[model samples]
Target: MTGSPAPVPDRATRIVVVGAGFAGFETVRRLLRHQRRSTDRPIRVTLISPDDFMLYTPLLPDVAGGLLDARFVAIPLAESLPGAELIAGRVDSVDFDGRTLQVRNREGAAETVEWERLVLTPGSVTRLFDIPGLAEHARGLKTATEALYLRDQMLEQIELAARETDPAVARARRTFVVVGASYAGTELTAQLRALADEAARHRGTVPDDVRFVLLDMADRVMPEVGEKLGDRVLEVLRGRGIDVRLGTTIDRLTAEAAELSDGTTIATRTVTWAAGVTASPLIQELGLPTEKGRLIVGADLSVPGDPDVFAAGDAAAVPDLAQRSGKGADDAITPPTAQHAVRQGKVVARNVIASIGVGTRKDYKHNDLGLVVDLGPRFAVANPVGVHLSGYPAKLVTRAYHLLALPRGANRMAVSAAYLGDAVFPRPLVSFGLVSADEASFPRSQGIPAPDSD
Candidate 1:
């Protein structure tokens, strides 16, 4: 007879959340809070991400423009998410039938972890196109590192342009092209224009030589805020000497120039591609039904057939109950925005807890709280709760919204301090020299493989 049978494994329920963006971070935080209040069952919360900090991505343009410190936007997960196991890794694949995940840690080791419940919030990445030389030369503004690199790159280009004996070379270096005129692209263009102006002054060069070109295929700038406010934003940008081009985009980009769709080519050394974002590549690897590259989930933010699997944020196509019209339910899906992601995180957390027999599940439904666009100093556009405001009032509302939206107390304080310092002192123009060109490339920083890669 055998001496003993195999020992039974721990029966505690395990919940694994992937990605630490707004949705995943909020989901983990809310779940941990619930675990502390309830003592009926044992629950293990695990968060798997490549980085240990959750990035407040809305402030990335500010960081890129040197208005805020990069460190202030990154919230340490270990400190913020207490009572949860933090695994530093990226999920490579998911075996939905087996209820397990294949993850590769920072050290390049692969590991398999089983989960009782799974939450997918691996947020979106820069939406790349098949345009030639795009992945090779274009830079993204998604992560903190990318933002810092952009700041340094802008400064470096300005410095180089100031000293070069060749006028053509200087002009090319001073010219900046920004694609996509939505929130990220618009904010980035405004902030960068200010930085370039200040840097040009410090370098003893003509600020007018430093040109910014903003391009978007849409007919208006920031149409999300409606026509009235959008028109105001366009006027502000034009007043700042930014060449805002509507109904136009880059057809091709090279190290020296960008060819526009309108059959015009401009000399430029830096091209910032803030075009758009699509769901993470991992979402498509599962062979699940997707809508516009995002995993399709029901109104309750749960997969149709898989009850234990939940999804939210940019990775999931969630139904917008608030906007449901007489047309059809499929016609109104939530737009992928940080506001929606944060709210969806809270709803997903409650539904997950309900699945574990703690409470009843509820559907996710929220109306628009309005939009805010910060266009450099003393200039902004906002429609708070359907009230349009521009200029100084809008600026105040925009800043207040950001400060209040930031989760951590320390981060908010640090950001506020940075803003105060910016008012009193000149913006810093020195490059840190920490991130290299290779290190900041799209393939290296954002983890998006090249087009030719298998």
Candidate 2:
């Protein structure tokens, strides 16, 4: 959507990449790498994302717990990738037949964008259930703002906990409950508990009696990784004084407590929900066949009926090793994870280039490369390269992986510095006051991409 290119960039050669998460960022990065090479017809890649930065969502909990600074999690888009047009807007809908996308600018106005190729890698959003009073009362840690809020709330909780004369009310104020035992929930609970411990220790007014509870309906933590890893994480969290409540759920939630299905209620002022993620509704706008809201795609990463359209990330249902091995009987699609998304982005970029005649297409394939979950600082669990690693070694591998995976320059250093700073001092607190639990409840919209005016 710009003035005619010097070579008129054949209308069919234009690609619009939506979302700037791990998958989208890698997609654009891989594309730019390819574009840098000499090509007969140059490709123009425009990236449309709500923010002009790629958020390091993996370390977000650290930010909340005061273990890292806010800036550590956000890498500006332009600085990360040189050639791609990093637009600061969001895509609203897709016109599959027209090969166009609709977007809303920061000003709330809508525009239509035509593309020769469209890659949707919008990624995941926080999931909500119908549990009473849960959405309104509990805060979310999915975004940077949520992290900031949780930090402020932690410090404020310490202050409030120290003041209430009634022991029960004070105990309720100090108790922090996190729901969901998946990676995000476990990591966030562990980190925040550490932060609370450190912050309380520094204040000296907060007591060792302060409580942290992590509740989930599943029988084990990290269920996505299977029972073995789940047991390991549960032990780690419980060892840190976190009450691990498995095979449980909050039947009712009040502003002050979560009533469990066991008929027992825990009084607490703060509830953090990291239960899981769902595909964005943007995929629904395509009016294409889908499985569980994710746009269904072929092995080549193209929509079955819409060749001009492509999708990856949590927004897509992609085949996995299990699926291909079984001849599509089980059709075990890869679950959503950063490891797969990064690889998928590379494949998607090549396929988009091939589709536009710049090269040949490649099918996407990758089994899990093992996973790393950092629980607090030196405590972590990783099955890296197929080796089960825990304690300091796992922590080292986890940090290194995230550092290497981060998109931009000096960000790795900045994040490392923040970690060091947190070690020496309490986590710094900043308040954006943006996005309430209510606003975040609704799924975000991806906007039409703007021309690379930057």
Looking at model 1, residue 106 earns an lDDT score of 68
lDDT of 2 by residue, 1-454 (tens): 2212223245326889999888899898888876777477578888988887888888888887777777878987776777777666768788777778888877888888888888999887667677887766776766777787777776676677788899998889888889898888889888888877776576664445678888888888886555777787878788888898888888888888899887899998888888877787577666788887687988888888777778898889987754577556566777888888888898998898888677788778786678888888568888886787778888889889988887765888988787677567765544454545444333332221112221
Runs off by more than 4 Å, candidate 2: 1-12, 205-207, 224-226, 326-329, 422-454
Mind giving the per-residue lDDT tens digits that candidate 1 earns over 24-131? Answer: 999998998876776676577888888989999989999999999888999998888888878888899999888899999767899898899999999999999988
The candidate maximizing lDDT is 1
Worst 10 residues of 2 by lDDT: 445-454
lDDT at 392, model 1: 93
RMSD of each candidate relative to the true structure: 4.4, 4.7
